[model samples]
Target: MNEIISGEKILVTGGAGFIGSNLCEVLLDSNNTVVCLDNFATGKQENIAPFLKHPKFSFIQGDIRNLEDCLLATKNVDYVLHQAALGSVPRSIKNPITTNEVNISGFLNMLVASRDHHIKRFVYAASSSTYGDSQALPKVEENIGKPLSPYAVTKLVNELYADVFFKTYGLETIGLRYFNVFGKRQDPNGAYAAVIPKFVKQFMQLESPIINGDGTFSRDFTYIDNVVQANLKSLVASSTSVNNVYNIAFGDRNTLNDLVVYLKEYLAIYKPSIEKVPVIYGSERVGDIPHSHASIQKAKKYLNYQPEFSLQKGLQEAVDWYWKNL
Candidate 1:
């Protein structure tokens, strides 16, 4: 087993985004020397603003699509948490070429850089969307289907590249197939904003929330803290866990309709009028999967994974953050 030690140099690509920023904060708190590389495309400096002055923190404003930048960021780094990419199915459907350049090309650049830098381990964010078109109730890593969208294709490609890198270059890599991750710091103003934060913001402003696909589409909705924990664990897990992919999600599912009800109930404390607001249903979204659940046994066995937050508890904490910030 490889133990993650204090004072190790770590480079976190996309470290200014929601999940990346949380991971940066955790690593910095644990006494790791952290370098954050981001282009500010979807990531905001405000997310990592507090860490700017920390002694062990460094920020490099650069894009991973640029090979020089990737190489420079990997210098003397012990580990890489590659999180930079364009996310969202609708966004990918609208402009797939751009998504490919960032997710696939950019990822390849990072892999090459990490291999050359001799980094001990590489952990990148893979997506549950990779299980596209598979009708299985709980998705497992070994059983996957044809990708349904450009975004799915990009993520599936990530797993493929990671596998090849391990076999051909002897680089240790782990891919985390994240389900619907949501929590504080998730952007609520974007056109392709995720459902949880988007709905929380709308309901806070007394606006009716929209439900795609008749509100029956369900998701595992893993919280951000669990994701941060998974990343840390992946970096420090035993050699037996290396060169593999794991499903990083809470083993539960909730329909969109159920999510709306939960959000309304939580928001009612701040806005009692929200209890009366109705949700509007629309046609199913293209590139949207009907249901998503993950079989997390592999992660549990290999990484000693133990998720501590449930949907309700996470949602309440997220709602409180929005109430104060938004």
Candidate 2:
């Protein structure tokens, strides 16, 4: 078993959310004391309920938008994993101001708090949506294009602030540009839910799933476990790993049609009728890129990252989890 350094105290903002809670569990399993700070805007207490009994786990109900809460959470923390942000392109498009407040301004609060606390490292969740208008097949770290949405703009601002903090204040920050992350604990009932979990939930209920485009649009859907691994690795990664950005993805792409077939097959065990349900097609979402695939070369070389699950394998595990939990 891989273990976090002894006596290390860690703070995870948004630690009650899908990705944050998973990271908290892994860190606790690795023998680290964890403080989970969340306002529950998008997070749920049930996600972290299993860890409430653990001696090393603590939960603080707080929002990142508040400087006092951020400071309190950062006190004596060795590492800061900033996952508290309002995600979803449509949500941002609908309400850019609130999204900016949480994703951009809130991120600044955490960065300032972390720097003040003298934290060892600050790792944050960036997004592949930052690739924006770029028409490249596989996005590399160095190449980027104009942001297509307010959400992408905010994420790009996060990277910029992280870089400035490192250069101006000597803070060690690493940004993980996640590409369509999905898996267990991801909310499937919401209006802005990611495709996989949403589809699984609809299929489980024998509802027609909707595809945003002609089902030709593809994405590099990464599993949650891989994202957790990237967070852990980025924390204690070599000194050379700081002040960098890495694409945390499976490196493969899957179209919505392929995903539908896989989901139907997996869900047939629980709801046998779902196999016959066909997915409905809709117009392409505004501000959405046509294709997105990431080059993991940088993460592979610098972070020693090795993705353990392929799309099919990950989908199977995710479907089973949704079936059992939902």
Candidate 3:
């Protein structure tokens, strides 16, 4: 992957959350002066505690919903990796008002701040959930269906705002449509926890994981490292007009059943008896997309996104983390 300019001042909104925290660490390692902005509404302090002592890292406890906080966090920043937003379809379904307040309104606040600061580029987290109800196997950037839940709507609005910001204000922006991203620091305890981490935690505890469907539903399951690479490439891409969206994924599909089997195998190294922990079938989740896969050709051609970790390889690392951390 191409490297972002070393020592560039970068502001990472929501840098205390799963994907954001991971991105901040990578950016710091690349020798950038990183500023992390988060309100801890959903972000965890422990996620960013390790970097507190790093000379290149600075933390700003703030909310994107507040324009002043956004301005404070982004002052003199060269680039903005806008990752702050409320996530979870079920949660959005339960309470879309709050999701929109955070995901949409807060996003607008950040864009205004980034525009005012004249940041070099703005790369924000878009989602596969934006493909809602579109039965296409390999979701492309151009084609999109109506959003199924409020969360999908929130993510879709980010893309729309990003495109408009680039066109109207001449601010360069790129949206990465991530598909099923998972890794260390991705919280596995919440009611809205992701499948991989949640399953790994359950298996480690000798508890049967509840699959939300018949184990046929599948996803691309992009690893966090690949996502971090995508963010880096987005920052350094040289195209004249980057007002576009790229699907960041490994471009491989695996059924939920396949995922559990691999998790069992990998976790068996830590606890030999975990292989026997069965997965219980439950009714499919409401508004759940039956299958999700991605076409990474666009990202590969434009952003030089070459994913190195497959599902099994990433799962092994995640299992190792949950084994020791949990």
Candidate 4:
């Protein structure tokens, strides 16, 4: 929290969405004047409603695909936390054109605007999916494989564009490759909703959620708070080189079955019958990674990032929030 540079003007690209809204809240709490630019395509209005009246909070309902929106939102902003992008590997497979248009084209637009405005640092969301089919257990930044899906390609392209912006245009940039980030306000109703929230919702309804691929596929389930820490560190720290990418994760892996167990355990406090809920196994979805893990050495050594929430700790908090809010 002390890392925040008070009074600095920060623009968060997807300010009405899950990760972006959390970033805006933290930045505003730190006394930074924050501007949010979102088109509401996937970002919900309810997510940003709490901050609509804040003195330091400004909202611009705009699309990143349009360069004019980027320029207007970035004007006079000191830093840009670029979190606006279409997510979900399955969704991208179904619609690559839209994903490319938003993730890649829109990302370039933000970079151009940030460069023109001379922003201090451009911290954008990268993805663990960039690892693709590499078969690496603890994913390192340098190692990667051919992207398995359009979504992976888009995120990887973001890293490339950020690197080019820093080298060619001299815009300082850092990319955080997030791993299975989950927390409150994350949309759980969508077809592409993340596993944790989706399962939480299903269990709340006393319904069984389907687990893909025998429930053995594991992921480094990072908590959103840890991701927030990484973003804040990258925004304020000069420890790492510009145009770099680091894995933002809990540095621990959990199987889908393991995740359900935790959710039931925590959620049972509110809905006693949820503990008896069952999960069915379905055929593995195409473009799904078998197992994923991350080595946080780079972020730790460079940005001094110390993840504050473990999977269990984050689940406790998330379950509590969902029970009260849902």
- The number of the candidate with the highest lDDT is 1
Report how far residue 170 has shifted in candidate 2, in Å. 0.6
Model 1 C-alpha lDDT per residue in residues 153-208, reported as the tens digit of each score: 99999999999999999999999999999998999998999999999999988898
Candidate 3 clashes between residue pairs 3 or more apart in a chain or in different chains = none
Q: Against the unseen true structure, what C-alpha lDDT does each candidate score?
A: 0.93, 0.92, 0.91, 0.92
Off by over 4 Å in 3: none
Residue 283 error, candidate 3, Å: 1.1
Pick the winner on lDDT between candidates 1 and 3.
Answer: 1
Which residue pairs clash in candidate 4?
none
Q: Which stretches of candidate 1 lie over 4 Å from their true place?
A: 1-5
Model 2, range 147-239, lDDT digits (tens) per residue? Answer: 999999999999999999999999999999999998899999788898889988888888898899899999999998888888888887899
Superposition TM-score, candidate 1 onto the true structure? 0.98
In candidate 3, position 285 carries an lDDT of: 87
Stretch of 10 with least lDDT, candidate 2: 1-10
Order the candidates by lDDT, highest first. 1, 4, 2, 3
| Prediction 4 TM-score vs. true | 0.98
Q: Give the alpha carbon lDDT tens digit for every residue of 221-311 in model 4.
A: 9988899889988987883556799999989899998999999999999989999998999999999999999999999988888998989
TM-score on alpha carbons, each prediction: 0.98, 0.98, 0.98, 0.98
